[model samples]
Target: MERPNNVPLPGVSAARAAERATSLAAHLDARHRGQNAQALIRAAVKDLFRGRIALVSSFGADSAVLLHLVAQVDPTTPVIFVDTGQLFEETLQYRDQLVALLGLTDVRSVGPKTDRLARLDPENFLWQSNPDLCCRIRKVEPLAEAIGDFPAWISGRKRFQNAFRAELPVFEGDGARIKVNPLAEWTGKDVEAYRLEHGLPEHPLVKFGYLSIGCAPCTDRVKPGEDPRAGRWRGRAKTECGIHIAGSMTPENEGSGI
Candidate 1:
């Protein structure tokens, strides 16, 4: 099973994409077990995943923390933003403002194919009747197609964001990619402190009690003392956009990679 140094590793190649996602996820989890978000970002962008890594951001409330960290580590790193075509105007504007301020060179805006939308959701009210399907076409599918080529990708999810996210790990495999969550341990206070300390721009909607901004139709303003993500998919059983959930990130079976 041992290969010589002259022989190139199969799964590590760019063409192979995420063939080594499981192994790399385990290694990164072990290597950066006790590191902070900044440290994890450095390893992901400059060392471990390097050219094969990307950071996905929603430009939602507290997103500035992870974006700022990734920008500092490597502004040229591919920043994948899933534009579900249902995003709020404020979120769109915030994405632009933050990218300009951060001087990120490779911020890519990806969305569902127009024809796909035309065929599946011409009425545009699918979110009301079938949120899961709407999310699949508008958010999950688009995001998967965007990040699928990368061996690894970073997410801004944190444990304190909601009940389901309370057990999130810093590193885990999502079938096709090693999904890194550098801010998994970050609290709301930690996010705010990082934003203020680094002078990062906040999402415009954050001040309006929209603590967890998402699509315009699904998101609502959060009440005081409620979870930051409580307003998302308000009055619905769905807590996630289906992108992360559909990926089936089983940190439990993987034994908590981080």
Candidate 2:
């Protein structure tokens, strides 16, 4: 019998899956490092993962550049957007604007389960008391569920975003799946240049200095001289939203938030 398209290889133990992701990440990183972003995305979407991969976009700040590149390569590629219930209204509108402008197909907007929210956070104050748990329910868990069937996924993280991401690789192993960062080598200037060169629309909030937009409650405007992601979860030690953390697919192991 033949395996179904886009489904993970069957019966592979978790350990085996992890090993495969590691090997694949190393291979892809070596082969595509320093290449153009479009070429990397093209290969991932059209040649390598093909039907088994998806793009996870936040549609904030410099997202339009990556979305435009992916649309150029293949507009029908699956795009996953985690609509944390607390996101800025501007972010949602920007998502819609970019989707229509880029002609993206298959944009999946996954959110935290309503039943889980009612049970764990009836008052929706989890972010004030336990941000890690809030992110687990709102961002990581939903994304994990959204990408459950994909063997690989793309992210828009770049090295210049912050110190924590200064050494981001072009590819990485996220538990059993391969995570590709086509823009890992791009700088803030590079992103802006691409957006201008391609005439992509900017995220509406960028003009107001919300360099790293996330959920409304946590995101803030950046100062004149700060890391692009500094405004995210301001005054908190949390640097990530737990979605990018290894083993984050499991709620119990959810790390920090971005």
lDDT of every model, 2 decimals: 0.78, 0.85
Model 2 lDDT, residue 252, Cα: 33
Candidate 2 least-lDDT 10 residues = 1-10
lDDT of 1 by residue, 1-258 (tens): 121111124445532333455555676688679998898889778877768888889998988888889988999999999899999999999999999899999999999888878988998998898887888788776776676547678999989988898878788767656788999988889889888898888888888899999999999999999999999898988898765773332222121111
RMSD of each: 6.1, 3.4
Model 2: lDDT of residue 198: 85
TM-score of 2: 0.92
Estimate the TM-score of every prediction: 0.87, 0.92
Name the weakest run of 10 consecutive residues (lDDT summed) in model 1.
249-258
Q: What shift in Å separates residue 20 of candidate 1 from its native position after superposition?
A: 6.2
Q: Model 2, residue 36: what's the lDDT?
A: 88
* Top lDDT hit: 2
- Which residue segments of model 2 deviate by more than 4 Å? 1-11, 250-258
Return the lDDT, model 2, position 177.
Answer: 80
